[model samples]
Target: MVRLMRALREERRWIAAAGLLFLISAVLGYFNARSLDETLRAAGVWERLERAVSVIRADPTFLKAFTLIYWNNVKAVLTMMGLGIFLGVFPLMALVSNGTMLGVVLAKTAQKTGANPLWLLMTTILPHGILELPAAIVGAAYGMRLGMMAAWGVWGLVTGGHREVVRHWRRLLERIPIVVVGILLFLLAAAAVESILITIVAK
Candidate 1:
């Protein structure tokens, strides 16, 4: 736990950047909900999402829903972390896309139900999102750190600073397990809350 906290503290800047990107994209999605919806529909993503929700809703025990939510999140976070080596592009893209999707959902729900968007968010997303969002941000942050390291490593190789690059890479490798475990724990808790609370609230 202490190591996890330290690791997170060390990567705070990247996390903050990821969070800000998500916030900005979410605002954009909210304001441009109609266009975003159209785009998603065109890409078939909207249909797929609807089908996924329907499947979850059909599950009475919520076990299927929980498994789906948790595994999906785990896969996405792991993908972001793994692909972050390429200048952190994947994590950045994930932040923007996920944030936009969330905002669009909120906007659409508010429009459809004529409910206050904030109220809908509070009831639906906030409970689990409070934990899930932070976990995602942390994962993205670590990915960004890896991307930065990769960039620096390239520079180091070019400048004959092999020892420094190797040392940093080793340290990052050591911290990754701690970081990943922490993110997984957060995801697990979030999934449990979402599966129970959000499922009930939705129904």
Candidate 2:
């Protein structure tokens, strides 16, 4: 936990940016849920069923985005968006947006359930989020390194010195082990949460 906090502190800008994105997303989700609930209440059974079918049809897009979005959300929750450690501006923006999306989902779920937010969060979110989020962080962390190298490479191209680029890339290569470890832990936890805990709780 201390290390995690340290990691967050070290990557504060990225994490904060992600968190901001989460807040925006949460607000949107809350309204969307409310709108859906209202529709659910007003619709006849057939209409509601039709809406459900529409949702099913949309699931493909959801899944495609969900793969990336899920991990991004997970990263925000864990407060592990540390791309700024390597790259600066772009990474920070990405982190912030990622974090905001996470916050939005959480906030929306809480609002959707009111008093039962924890239960919903634990069951619905804790499942895939556990693995997906961490994997995102690992990816983000690596991206930070790549971004830094790319940025430096560009700078070197305009000005003239490959030293920084080589140095940053070398350090990034060393971080591969850390990313692997982080992703592995995240995936393992997510699998258990999704496959076991959520089912048991839902039952």
TM-score for each prediction? 0.93, 0.50
**How does residue 185 of candidate 2 score in lDDT?**
64
Worst 10 residues of 1 by lDDT: 56-65
Please, what are the lDDT tens digits per residue for candidate 2 over residues 86-130? 454555555544454444456565765685656776777656565
Q: For model 2, where is the 10-residue window of minimal lDDT? A: 60-69
* Per-candidate total of colliding backbone pairs: 0, 17
True-vs-predicted CA distance for residue 196, candidate 2, Å: 0.8
Residue 10 Cα positional deviation in candidate 2, in Å, after optimal superposition: 7.1
TM-score of 1: 0.93
Cα lDDT tens digits, model 1, 135-182, are 998898888889999999999999999899999899889889999999
Q: Candidate 1 regions off by >4 Å?
A: 198-203
